[model samples]
Target: LDIAFIVEGSDNVGEENFNIVKKFLERVITGMNVGQEDIHVTVMQYSETVTLEYSFREIQSKESIIEKVRSIPYQGGKATNTGNALNYISKHTFTLVNGGRQDVPHLVYMVSSSPSTDVITRPPRSINVIPIGITPNANIQELRRISQPNNPIILHSYSTLIEEAPELVLQSCCSRKLWTEIPELCNKPMDVMFLLDGSSNIGASEFEEMKNFVRAFIESAEISNTSIHVSVLQYARENNLEISWNVPQETEKLVEMVHSIQQREQGPTRLGRAIDFVVQNAMSESHGGRPSASKVAIVIVSGRSEDTVEAAALSARMNRVSLFPIGVGNRYDEEQLRTLTGPSAANRIMKLQNFEDLSTMITLNSEFIKKVCMDPVRECIDEDGNKKKPGDKWTLPDQCHTVTCFPGDYTVLESHQINCERMPKPVCHSNLPAVKIEETCGCRWMCPC
Candidate 1:
């Protein structure tokens, strides 16, 4: 694994907090294998100016790497130039000459205490960036912009990072399997409903684009009765069941229905009524909603609704369904969208500038489903087939031999000594009388003799 740490050194992070950041990095280093063959590390410091303090080639061992980290003086500056830092790392550090091998997995971990001065253009997909925000101050929007979809890791403070560093190192450094694998929707069972807006606000062309987006999303996933059962509902002042989960349609049939779907002409946007209809009629037991399976509702809207959405949204939440409201274009009410999605709305709500950019939602929605649907892999399962959570004192897998050495005491009381006797009582003619008395006591102990 080739990994880089781009630590924040903005002036807001004073000398004390700067040392705390370094200490956190050191803790993470202690948990990495960090040798020539495993887990090479590069450390960078970024503030108003970006500095590559050390390159991957300089990384020799974990102990030496941690020592170098401790020696870095705080490069406190006025602004947080995260954009330049991200760009620099992508262009310069992650290269063949810098000990970055194309065959191995590469990762960038950025720790920032403040928002970036400039907008962050995402780095290449090959180098996965996990932005760790030191919270209460870290800008989440900027963090999310830099990280992979649904993959930002936020810590409450530098103090809490010690607890998360081991897992961080394990996930980023030890295994490439998780990062390389593209998540498949059919792997987990889910009940999904796509509630789309078909109203006067959306033109015919825009509606067609929306359908294309839906088609892409649907075609990407495997759909069946056992996994990812899907339904589509189109609405304006009234609602239409375009694809019903109650009627069993295989993945092929589902895609075909979306292909031939038509838009409703000249109807007002009544999003609230549509949501209520789904909660009452579409997601019921008769409509193929299995309580055992995860229930997800995605509302795609292009404009403000004609009626209130709170009551209907609350009903969906009360029923334990996760609602994701996507606001397309600039005209929709931001507050309504946020309310419909609930708290952490920024994380759940997909706000797009135009309908043409709906392809971005595929990765975002896929990642969201992967995260909210299933629990992470567990080590053990009970007889009832329930997986057990990690117990206390359970050490994480040291796949790269992160903790190879142990501290112990050694006894070595029998110390050796080296001595040089006074040269044979130098017989100087001028000081013969003074030298003669000194020469008589010339004998010295090499080891107490």
Candidate 2:
């Protein structure tokens, strides 16, 4: 979750009350776990103009954030410019460059005791705006207009607001385990293989967590040899096959093998060798990898590979195998991981703080694989963010979402950055592929008219 607090610093706000607001924020920050993958909080003080007191990207620790909050000076101005502040946040603050992930929920809390000088229209981005009125003088009607529908305005004096700060913030940053309820894609035939890093860098404890992650993933999936064939391989200097595609169509047996699989420690991280091993040994028809089924290889890496990995990963993709490289530790090379994962790096390459975080990958991995198997026809996108030409063959990065456009005989109008659902009804006449929408809006493939 990404949260931004927009505090009103007009002349109406006395220093004592402003200090209380800072304390309220301090309490809120203390109660939350502020980290890169977890909650990130930013603060901006607004009067006639918005002043960014601190960005979430800069402060990852709760102590650091609270200390910075304490140091923030009051920017008292003549009147409140709430509309301009919202506009500024919408245009500049809430962006990927500013540590904002579009997939996560964004929330804004506005603290004010006065009316805005301008109208508060809906911002360009989707965000839940909460109006926190500090005094009875605050405009209730304006708060209603600015806030999310049915979300009550938190109207209280500075002292009272400080007291209820913890409860209010908890409501905004509650556990998102409920949000992970994605519908399972049943009866989708897929041949999925996992290439796990068991190098010394990963250690025994971390490897155990990785195994648990695989087990959880298998348990969540609707697995059967006919439905979704599963395979597991541990790799370092060499690869050791734990489970094969030809294994019985029993989920229990597969999970049993996952639990029994031991670590292959004290080997150099020759990840390239492991990639080639999957392409040559696992992805073959004789190895229970159905050519018609969705073929995917998930590579989990803890540290930098001792050998080159890009070419071998490319080879697997050329053979119609989707590649997903998960970089677990902070020591792993990010660029190399991106190269191995291919395009759409954000969705493909998952960087974790430690092996303990592998549990989080279970949901993401299951959903991504299921989605790809539901529709395996992935179109390649170019560096210019345009769809690849027909027959200009390319491999899709792992979790690469694409929408095929049908161009029969009519002129195929090229549209960019549009919602697929909002596009005109598919009346095809051109020679383009039919527009197939994926579950995520991350796809930038061509959408036909």
Over 4 Å off, model 2: 1-182, 344-346, 363-377, 381-386, 391-449
TM-score of each: 0.49, 0.47
lDDT of 2 by residue, 62-120 (tens): 98889999999988889798889989888877798887778777778788889887777
lDDT of 1 by residue, 186-303 (tens): 5667888888788878887678667756665665466666678888899998888888777665755776788688887647999888888988888887877777777777788878
State the weakest 10-residue window (summed lDDT) of model 1.
403-412
Winning model by lDDT: 2
Once model 2 is optimally superposed onto the true structure by TM-score, how far is the C-alpha of residue 3 displaced, in angstroms?
A: 27
**lDDT (CA) for every model shown?**
0.69, 0.70
Q: Return the number of clashes found in candidate 2.
A: 16
